[model samples]
Target: MASITLKTPSLSYDIHIAAGLLRTLYPRLKKLYPAKKSFRPIIVTSENIWALWSKDVLASFPEPPTVLFHPVGEKHKRLAAVEKLADQMVEAGADRDTLLLALGGGVVGDLTGFLAAIYMRGIPYVQLPTTLLAQVDSSLGGKTGVNLATGKNLIGSFHHPLAVFADTNVLATLPPEELRAGLHESIKAGIIYDPKLFKYMQANAEAILAADPAALTKVVAASVKVKAEVVGLDEKENGLRMILNFGHTLGHAIEAATQYKQLLHGEAVAWGSIAAVQLAVSRDALSEEDANKIVNTIMTYGPLPQFRADAKRLVTLTAGDKKRRSGRRAFVLPKAIGTVEVVYDVTDAELLSAANSMLTLMKAQA
Candidate 1:
């Protein structure tokens, strides 16, 4: 078991990573919320996830929880979904004492967290992230929100969970594509903050891809540590936290271009990371040798799915990205494999050029 503590402006929470942790969830909740505190535990999950793991989860509890289903998809992540979930809780007589257990992937965690943030003017919740992506990235940071048609995560809040229980065992049921998609965020963590993590992933690519228990656990722990450190410093993405968006600037644009239907979030970010590296090379911020290494590593994760979108259109979509501050776009570009810089002065021409490069490479590989 790997235990990490993340301390933010409001409070600190523990992220527990291990296999078979889901079987012991009831005890963990008991430790967090004693019997003296009568709180209704409600689980927010999707039908697919519930079908696979609900038995073990329910067995952990003394009684069955009020389970609410939220459909899985980037397109379904919206204010309306949160409102509907909130309505369900209202019908169930939920109040400030309701404890929301987010028990699925990123969409479920984000929706449940956002629901907790606004329900009764903010309640408490814990993340039971079942996907590799959620376990490593989305589940750790306090970022919870749904996407707007304009961009991803446009409407959200900084509501931290009481704790995060990431059972690596749950990943055994993930589809190959989903597993591959999630590894991109781990790569993003390595690119932005942890050089050791980068080399580890490079060396253990085979084992990681195979979903070896040891390799996946290490990746989750290392990636969570990187995010915990960053969020600890900048809880609200004020300064240092912006570096976490290394590949997300254009990545979100890619998602919007396809209308969130074609590519997964991690796949889009993988291409966006390539584009950022292209921009870095053009700006002379990174050497060709290092650039080749970064791009190759991204591809090493495998044949990222291809998407069709005009470079100009992708660039145009970025203007609506929530990362913009004071109406100026912000971008996180890499200076090296393990170092990145956040810049606000990136021009549309530069972005269009990078997007073109990314699209060209994506097509060539296809």
Candidate 2:
């Protein structure tokens, strides 16, 4: 097992990564919150994941939990879903002392964490992220929210989880595309902080794709360590934490333009990373050599889905991104393989060009 502790001004929590940590969840929770005898566990999950892993999760508890199922997919990540789950929590006799167990991927973790954030003021929650994307990124960041029609994650809060248990065993059941989606985030982590991790993935792409346990553990643990250090420095994303949004500025815009239906979050991010690299090269912030390496690394996963949104529309959506500040949008562009900088000087025309470049790349690859 690999463990990383995230300490911020608001909270501190341990992220545990192991193959079968799901089975140890009950005892772990007991040790963490030993004084709360009346605390009930509400397992929030999607119908799809519930069918597959609910039995294993329930077996980890002393008794069956109050299971609340939401529809799966990014399209279902909305205020309506959160409201529906909140209603379920109310009817289940939940109180401030209740604990929410987020038991699926990012959507489930986000919705459940957001629900706990605002439910009767606040409640404790634990993240049991079942997907690679969630395990390496969303599950640890304390970033919880549902998407609005206007943009992605525009109506979210920074509600940290009490603990995160990432069971790599659940990853074996992931579809190939979902697994690839996660590799994109891990790639971003490597590009922004750890060059050794980038080379690790480049060397073990085949084994990681084959779901080799050792390779998966190393990739996830390395990604989590990068995020944990960043979050510790800037938990609210006011300063140093913005670098974590390396591929996310245009990525969120792409997701919004596509209505979150066609492209997975990490797929959009992979495309966005390509665009950011193009922009960085144009600005002379990154060498074309490094840019090519970054792009080639992402393309190794091969043949990302093509998006057809107008470049102007994609650029327009970026105005609504949460990372915008002082009337100028900020972008995290790479300076090299293991370094990035957040700048707010990018022009609108530059953004449009980058978006179009991403479209062209996707079409060519497709």
Candidate 3:
């Protein structure tokens, strides 16, 4: 098992990564939440995940939890879903003492965490992220929110989890595309902080793609460590933490333009990373050779699902990104394989150029 600790001004927690960690969840929760308090467990999950893993999760508890199920997909992540979840919790007589167990992927984690954040002003929650994307990125960040029709993650709060249980065993059941989607964030981590980790992915692409336990464990732990360090330094994305959004600026825009239906978060990120690299090279911040390496690394795991949205629309959507300030938006562009800088000097024309170049590359590959 690999463990990483995240410390923030608001809260601190440990993320445990191991196969079969789910079985240990009840005991861990008991230690964290104790028997002294009259807290009730509410397992928030998707219908698909509930069917597959609810039995294992329920077996860990002394009593049956208040299991709430939502239909799966990015399209389902909205204020309406949050409202419905809150209504369900209200009917169950939930209060600040209610413990939310976010038990699926990013959507489940995000929605559940948000529900806990606003429920009775704030409640405790644990993240039981089941997907690769959630395990590597969203599950640990304390970033919880649902999307609005205007943009991705526009309505959310920073409510840290009490603990995060990232069970590697659940990853075996992931569809190949979903697994690849998760890899994009790990790739982002490597590009922004750890060169060795980036090389590990490059050298063991085959094993990683095969879902080899050792390789996956190493990658997950390394990625988590990078994020933990960054989050520790700047909890609210004030300065140092913005680098973690390397591919997310345009990535979020791409997701919004596509209406969250056409592309997975990781897939949008993969393409967005490519666009960021292109913009970096155009500005002489990164070498063309290094840009090619980054692009090829992403391509190794993708021939991402095809989707079409206008470049103008993508550029327009960037206005809604959380990173925007005053009249400019921050773009985390690579200076090299293991270094990135957040800059606001980028122009709309430059963004349009990159978006066009990315669309062209996607069409060519398709």
Candidate 4:
């Protein structure tokens, strides 16, 4: 097992990466909450995941957990959905002692974390992220929220999970597209920090995609370490943490533009990453060769599913990004692989150029 501990200003948590964690999760929960604590374990998961892995999950618990099913997809990630989940928790007789187990992908994890944050002035939750995206990026960040009509993650909080159990065994059942989408976030981790991870991914794409246990564990552990280091330094996105959003500004815009239907979150981010690198090249913040390498690495993951959007429209949607500070958009631009700088001075013209360049690349790939 590969373990990484993330210490933030308010609290610290451990992220455990390995295969077969689900099969042996009960004892771990006992260690955290303890049998005498009388805490209730309520699992918030999608129907799809529960159908596949509930057996292993249930086997670990001495008592059957109260499972609440949240529908999957970005469209379902809203305040209303959370309210409904809260209602279900109430119906299940939950309280401050209720411990939410987020047991699926990003959507499940984000919604559960947000529910835990506001439920009875905050209850504890642990992430059992089954998908690659959630396991590596969303699960460990302590960032949780739902999307708004205007943008993604517009309503959320920084409620950290008590622990994150990224069991690689669950990934075997992940759809190929979903698996590829999750890998893109790992690539983002490499882009912002850890050139070694970037190269490892480049050198071992086949094994990772093939769901080779050792390869997946290394990629997940490395990506978690990169995020852990960043979250430790700046728990609240005051400075260094902004670099983690290297491709997310435009990526969120792309999600909102398509009404969150056409592409997975990671697929949209992959395209946004291309656009960001293009902007960096235009601004001379990154070399053409290095930018190509970055873009190529993103593409190496797979043919990112194609989507249609006007370049100008994507540029316009970014205006609603929640990451803006003091009314100025903070764009994370790469200075090189394994390095990035957040700049608030990116112009509309530059955004349009970058969006257009990204569109061109997408068209060629299509």
Best by lDDT: 4
Q: What TM-score does candidate 1 get on C-alpha atoms?
A: 0.99
Candidate 2 lDDT over 264-301, as tens digits, reads 99999999999999999988989989998999989987
Q: What does candidate 4's lDDT look like per residue over 56-109, in tens digits?
A: 998878889899998889999999999999999999999988889999999999
Q: What 10-residue stretch in candidate 4 is worst by lDDT?
A: 30-39
Checking candidate 2 for backbone clashes, the offending pairs are: none
Model 4 residue runs over 4 Å out of place are none
lDDT of 1 by residue, 1-366 (tens): 899999987789999999888888988987887668787899999999999999889878988989999998989999999989989999998988889999999888998999999899899999999999999999877889998888899899989999999999999999988898899999999999998999999888999999999999999999999999999999999899999898888899999999999998899999999999999999999999888888888899977988889999999999889889999999998888889999989999999999999989988987
Q: Clashing residue pairs in candidate 4, if any?
A: none
lDDT of each: 0.91, 0.90, 0.91, 0.92
Return whichever of 3 and 4 wins on lDDT: 4
lDDT of 2: 0.90
Clashes of 4: 0
Q: Which RMSD values do the candidates have, in order?
A: 0.9, 1.1, 1.0, 0.9
Candidate 1 lDDT for residue 318: 93
